[model samples]
Structures are given as C-alpha cells and as structure tokens.
Target: MLNPQWLRSFAALIEQGSFTRCAEYLDLTQAAVSQHVQKLEERLGPLLIRRPRQLELTPAGHALLEYCEEVSAADQRLNKRLSEHDDKHGEISLICPGSIGLALYPMLLNLQQTNPGLIVRQRFAPDKEVLEGVLENRFELGLATLKPDDPRLLVSRFTEEPLELIAPVSERVEGWEDLKRIGFIDHPDGRAMSSRLLSRYFPEAPGIGSLPCHGFTNQIGLILEPVARGLGFTVLPRSARLAFQRPESIQVIEGPRLVEDTLWLIHRAEWPLSTRAKLVVKTLKAQIEGLSLRNHACRRA
Candidate 1:
C-alpha cells in the first residue's frame, strides 16, 4: 500500500527543490524527509534524485510526482465530502500578508467564537510564498498584494487599500531633497511600491537609488517602528496603518496619491475547498468589503 505521508514529503521536496527546505516546510527533520523518499524508492523501484551540484528529479521521480499529486487531490476531495456530514467543522488553513491578516484577524476570531466547531489557522507570508503555499495544498487560501502569472491558480479581487508615504511626525517632506535627507525604511514590498510611487509622484528622481535605505526588515509590523523613532520614512498600506499600535508617532507625508494596492485572494484552481474553508473565505470577503467601505468613509470625512 502506498503511504500518503511519504507522498506528501516527496511532493514538498519536489516543490521546494531541497530536502532541507522541504523538511522546514513540512516541519520534519532532514533525515526524515530523506527516509520518506527512500521508502518510496524501495517500494516503487529506484527513484533517483540527482544531487551534489543541484537536485533534479529522475524520470521515475517525475512520473511519481503526477501520481502522487492526483492521489493527494482525490484524497482531499473525498475527505472534504465525508466531513460535510460530520458534526464538527474541519480545520481551515490560510496564508496572507501581515497587513491583511492584521486587519482580518478580529473577524476570524469572532467567527470561531460563534462556531465553536470551526478552527482557523492563519500565517503571515510574503506574496510569493502565499501563492506557493496554496498551490502546494499547504494552505487552503491565500491573500496577496500581487497575483501570480500561473493559470493554475484562481485569483479574485479582495479589496484595495490606500497607500501612504509615512515619516516621523517631526520631519517634513516636500520634494526630492527632503526625501533624500529623510532616507527610507525598507520592508518586504517597500522596494517595488516605492519604485512605482517614485516614478509616478517624484519625477525628479528616476529610481530608488536617489532615496537611500537605512535598514530593511522582513516583518511588516516592525517596519513602522523605525520610522516612529525618527530613523527613516516608509510607504505602507492603510491596513498596515490601522494595524500599527502607535499611529500617532508617525505622520502621513504630503505627496502625490499613487494608485492603491489591490489585495487578491488566491487558491489552486483544481483543488476543491472544504465546506469550512469555503465558509472562512466568505467571512473574509465580507469583512474585507466592510473594511474598504470604512476606509472610503474615512477618506471622505
């Protein structure tokens, strides 16, 4: 009998490209991931994986990948259908940007409180990682600022949040000179967003080279702190502003209002979402809509 556990490890290894990364993604030891692949090879003949320079799946390994994916998809579908009749709601896993997750977490908590049977797990990941997580069945759904080009993933507009250039309350930003003097606090999406905003708003400076960055942080929540302490300015979405604990410490710098960033909900096109997962998605959509409306009202007021 084929072990689903081993197949899962193999699939992760294939997607992640390295046993170490696959093990990290799957929360398994490196030795364990290797062992799982070895077991599969033992059962279904040699599944040679090229190593040393780079890892490449052998012909057998590639063939096994298709079978494993199909089997996993079928199993998930069957399990989803079976669980519909059960009294308890199954788990729902989601990956989203820190900003979106911060804004939507309250609604999720309220949902779990009302429906005790449902359990929701949310993790903050970069846009790229979120897309990969949903594609690999590691997450049921994902929210991201950027959509992947892959046709296999279904993308839908979630909501648009206003982006603002923020600086310490003490600093003043008027033109290129002021911006260059203040510097920038780089975050995960900072470079891309900053570049686009600069190109549109500040025509004088062509690229990011004109505005130097003092430091960088992968953690979105922490990105604002440095700015608050008068370190450097950063551009962030409205949701991020709402999530920031001390908004009073920083001020929105007066500048050209660039286009807002649209957050997208993404999932694998082929995979069927479980009933509980579907419910979570619905809740998230409604909450996001309400948030957009509120943001609009705030802007008008």
Candidate 2:
C-alpha cells in the first residue's frame, strides 16, 4: 500500500510546480519531498518524467494524482460533516415494540416538526425484532420490553409502562369470573401481558388460553378497538391504552397489584450515539416521563 504521506507530497509537488516549492509549502526539506516521490514510484512505478525545466507526470502519476484528489475531497467532506454534527440535525433510525410506538411515533413526529433538520425514522416491531435490528445495525436505536442478553448491546431502562386490564366502560370487573365472562381481545402481546397481570391479582385465575377469544388484532393502534366497542376486555401497556382513539369508552380496572413492563433502550455497545440520537433519546425520555406523571395523576383522581 502506498503511504498517504507520500501521496500528499506528490500532490503538493504537482500543485506547487517544483520540488523545492513543494517542500517549502509542506514545511519539509526538499530531500524529504524527493524521497516521498521516490517511495511512491517504487510502489506504483514510473510516476513522473524528469525534465530540465519542469517535471511531467506519467500515466501512472496522473492516475495517482486523480485518486489523491478524490481522497482529499472525501476527507474534507467527512471533516465538514463531523464538525456540523450537533443535536439539532441528522437522522435517527429506531425500532421499538408496537405498544410504545403507538405513543412515541406522534411525539417523535412532533419533535421533527420543531427541529426541521432532524429526520426521524421509526419502526413498530416486537422485542425480538427490536433486538435484532439494533444488533444488525439496521437501526441506531431500539426500545424493547425485554433486556437483551447480548454483550454487543448497551442497554438501559428507559421507562416502565404499567400493564392495565381494560374493559368497556359499562363492564364491571370484580374478579377472575368477570374477565372470563367478558372474554379476551387478543393482540400479539395480549396473552403474555394478561398472564403477568392476572396471576398477580387473581392467583386462582386459569391460564390465559382458557379465556374465550372474543377478537384478535395485530395492529397496536386497533388492539383496543374491540374493548372500546364493548366486545371484550384486554391487557395493554399504559402507552397503548392512552393512545387509543376512544379513551372514554374503556376503563382501566384497578387491581390490588400494579404490573409494569420495563422498556429498555438499546444500541451498539461499541459505538457512541451521535449527537442527534442523544437528542432524540432525551426528548423521548422527557415525553414518556410526562405521560407517566399525567397517567398517575389521573389514576389518583
């Protein structure tokens, strides 16, 4: 491989039009410049034709010069981009579970609206997909309900969302019998969430599979639609429940024990987050905290 210093010297020699002038420009002795050119020729062969008045470039020299120019230009562009990298701009690619996405997507859009230069690309996925996307570099950030065990991931608790048992406003949920009678509106996470919350509050309740499936929808936004229409009850994170279109139509059944899922934020452990990503993370945390506070206040009232 040709040394970059040799290439720099060669480019300078051509630009300055003399070995002496090039050496002066580069703050090196003329011998050093000559040696640089000699080494380059040894690696790449016949780069320059010596002449009495002026040095002329051979075909190989011309090619090397062009390559040097391209390298220099690319270096300049990279430097400029790095210098300009700040919290206000750039793209943040993130993948997260659908429940958080339901609440976070709109807030991220609002952040983009306020910072026009910041571009947000968000995907709704399950915990497995979220972990995979981050590990594969498909996304710069990820949010998952389960903490990944992979050593390549840098994980931190972002927030905890309470899992709520939601039913049509008219349904009175008193115990296990009430949920069985109301039936179950199952989504992708409906069974798992129901099992965790139910087993804590209603220890005698049979496994979630025994409940009659009143409806099923994979779309997070529409998961609560059945419950809102008085079709059945379902379990969901507070974020999803808050994002439902008809919040007044469904009620969060107060249980003796509160169940919450900890949302973990993950990224590549080897790479530091860009300024723009840090900004996005900060904004997301603030918004999620506010949501939690508001929900808690409402529950207290």
Error of 2 at 3 (Å): 19
* Candidate lDDT values, in order: 0.83, 0.89
lDDT tens digits by residue: candidate 2, 92-163: 789998988889888899988999987789999998889889999889899999888999999999999899
Badly placed stretches (over 4 Å) of model 1 are 1-81, 84-88
- Residues 142-196 of candidate 1 have per-residue lDDT tens digits of 9888867789888888877677888898898887788788889998889887876
Best by TM-score: 2
- TM-scores, all candidates, are 0.70, 0.73
- Residue 109, candidate 2: Cα error in Å is 1.7
TM-score of 1: 0.70
* Alpha-carbon lDDT of model 1: 0.83
TM-score: model 2 vs. ground truth: 0.73
